[model samples]
Target: MHVLWRGDTLQRLRLVSGLILFTFAATHFINHSLGLISVDWMHEMQKWRWVVTRSWPGTIVLLAALLTHASLGLYKLAGRATLRLPRWELVQILLGISIPFLLLPHIINTRIAHVFFNVNDIYVYELAKLWPASAIIQSLLLVIVWVHGCMGIHFWMRLYPAYRRIFPLLLTLAVIIPLSALGGFAVAGSNVAAAIEIPSVFANLKVLTRWPDAAASESLAWLRNLARIEFGAVLAVIFGCIAWTYFARVAGPKVTVAYTSGPTVRVPQGPTLLEISRMSRVPHASVCGGRARCSTCRVRIERGSYGLPPPVFPEVVTLGSIGAPPNVRLACQIRPEHYLIVTRLLKSETAGPEDIAIEEADSAGVEKTLAVMFVDLRDFTRLSEKRLPFDVVYVLNEFFGVVGAAITEHGGWIDKFLGDGLLAVFGQRDGVEAGCRQALRTARDVDLALDHINAKLEAELGRPLAVGIGIDAGPLLVGRIGYGESVDFTVIGNPVNVASRLESLTKERDVQLIMSRGVVRMTGWIPPAALTDQVSVRGVAEPVGIIMVKRGRELPADVLALRAEEKEKEKPAAWTAGFWGRR
Candidate 1:
């Protein structure tokens, strides 16, 4: 009971064991690929590999990992309150369970025969036996094992910040290794078949003496049959445990789960809210497939919240990172032991792979000094009042296109579009200093882009387009917020609100851009004393320090020139701080 309940430790052990087994499988496939050159090459590589893997210590470690991983996997599955899972998770599980059945027979014939019956079990001998008869099964074993290992690796690796950058290379190797191994096996098998046709080669091969005697061959057969029976018994016991757990949960007690969305379901006790939602066919978001890495599956307990167990470590980390309130809990982590009314925080239909693909800086969430920018086109509404609806929409899309491009180009993401305005946040992945510098440059680019747009629309429009830009930099609580389809990954704090106020102030102040003093300072630039002012901002108790620019294009020439010189001085230190140093 103690061992089973320590889920975090068991999960870590399972990951370690899985990685060890994956390494072995990868190396074995690489050895098999050597057969592409010649069967002798395969044997040569195998001999080198055997130095570690075929040794007593290596064998013991390999067997231990195999047992640990298999048992842990079975236990994890049996512990699941519901069999319903994401498509990829279900596929990985099915493939993992299928591996032992296909693999045990092969292991018995080769490793067992080598140790007990003194069979050579060399590539040529085995290939000759396997060529046309056992080829399909061996191929299946190779693919199933590789895919299962790769999926497990994917599930684990995707949680990291660097996984996305290295994924393409990983995917290529995954595909190439298995195909090369299968190709090598086919070529080697053909060579063996050809050699066997020659009387001299066949005699030298000693195909009949591969097994010591008829008795040894009969004994190998009996061992394989017994191994199959033993494996079957183990599987049967695992399934029996799962079935007993399910039936016991059903018969022992029942609870009513009332969803705020108006569905009240009577589900058996034991399943988590997520499992219950799936069982009841309710729409609930789970971007990390119930792993608790993403808090998209969070639900607010509307009623019956008392007596609930505390969140586990993973859930605590995720919820704390996102700054979730006290009443909210991860649906995937908590089992409703009693009747409870809950509301899903995110819409399942709107959640996608991208929802879990958080950036390096925004893994869950935390406080970071970031540059927040707000851009709004001035008087586009009045311009649209006289123009055709089609023309208005067309020009608006074009306006947004340039704005979006400039935002992304300057290392920020457009958090959301506000009809004629948009919010962009920087330093989410890059640092605050870079974000401030980039925001200044983005303002300049937007001003330039508008000029080009105005030139193109000169005949259609009586006047040129105009825009206001605002930038602020400070510590902000950055994370995903909102419910259902309206969920947004955004920053919230004084800085964000200040930026919005500054953008609106641009119209009254008659300027193209307005930036907080902190933003200018973060960029390593001192604003001109004459251009700076202390002004009262709506909703803010104190006056805010700001630097205004009448025209963005003129401002960057002075600001970026000073920055360029500073960056030149930094080149030496920057070179020392390469990819890893950036972190």
Candidate 2:
């Protein structure tokens, strides 16, 4: 018999079952919330709820989902190769384990009793029988089940953009639904207790419910004890799996893994490369917790490729989906069989939620022709040295605000801010020529914005702040890079380095802006027919050809006309005053 234990198939099964279980829990909680109105209302809702839940089809599906979710959850736990888990994952596991123990007693008391002993397990009957004594246990079950379900939903949905957009509303409902249910449960229980104090209400309930006889009551008590013992046995088996896993680690033969990033580990032969990295305290990316969902944990096998086993179907599909090269394999899926040398293809710290959208190979990190711009504040440091720190911060914020707006306005993203400057990239979506044009336009707009800001802050400043702008365009590896929380989507290549050098060279050349011949060629823009010089830039083998602008105000007549057209567009229309005045 062929067993379907593929990681992707198991993940899908886990998700579908979890959703079904969560839906049932949510509906049950809503039904309990009706108890806040009256005990009769709670009974009314229970009848409607049971119409579906107690039906044969509904019962079959619910049981299947419950069993699947529980078994798969435990299987995942047992299959874990490393115990070094994130805090949230640890919390989720603990909560999930606690759920079955808390849940079994409630299920037996209701569903089992209703089927075997003809007990009417409605809200009214349950509240009358067990409310005052078993209230705390029931309440704990209510809370634990709902929270476990929510965490499961959160873990999967957090990978999606739509879920994140409405997360606030979802969070509000998560809190309010459980609180309402708990309140209703408390109020209804008290009402039932109060009503039972009178002889008529208490006597009426006794007749309505099929109060088990002495023998039946004894059988029910025996069943509950049996359930407790069985559940304890299950716990023992689970714990035994954990113990065996640890023991096997010591008993098994070890394989040597030499990571190109410096760590060399000798781990048991059974674990995957990602687990080996974790065991050795070497950082490796696994954005989806080694589920083979995200391709972040991919690594290149530099050596021992010939000896390595071929990838399984699921791993092949995942790797193929991302257009990964032949040498690359998912570190989370491939278990090294012998001594191997590998390098993590993606930065461990730079992986984030944005990785979900990175389907194309270029976004994962490939050489692409794009524009890079570097802008820096000139002489503002010495100017700020004489002012209060707060004052300097205020000015910097204003400076960044205008410069940042100009960059984005022309189709670029701010990569990072150096102390007195910022790096920006263009042409991620648009083509190379378009990116180059956008970068040039942004440079012109930055000069215009600085003039406006300097005029605004002229009273406080002894002189206007000057800025140096540099533009370069070429093939660069653009992608998300960094470590942990400091990760960013940016570019890294010769173009980035050259742009920074040109920005620095502006200070020496006493020019406001500098663009390499490559940028000028891409944009097809002609500079004034004057003395053009080639300057040797650091890190480049040969001198780079360039163009320079002494002052932004000295830009070509056609380019300066853009600022005039912008001003003309900004002027309010004659009828605008009446619109606001009427409002």
Best by TM-score: 1
Candidate 1 structure quality by residue, lDDT tens digits, 460-532: 8788999998899889876556553344456778988899999999998999999998898887777678889
- Alpha-carbon deviation at 520 in model 2, angstroms: 21
Kindly give the number of clashing pairs for every candidate: 0, 1
> lDDT per prediction?
0.79, 0.78
Expressed as tens digits, the lDDT of each residue in 83-176 for candidate 2 is 7765667888888988877677778778888898898787888887667898898899889888888987876666555776699899999999
**Which residue pairs show collisions in model 2?**
349-484
Segments in model 1 whose C-alpha atoms lie over 4 Å from true places? 1-7, 207-209, 212-215, 218-252, 261-263, 285-298, 311-328, 343-365, 369-371, 380-413, 416-420, 426-465, 472-475, 480-489, 493-498, 501-583
Report the CA-based lDDT of candidate 1 relative to the real structure.
0.79
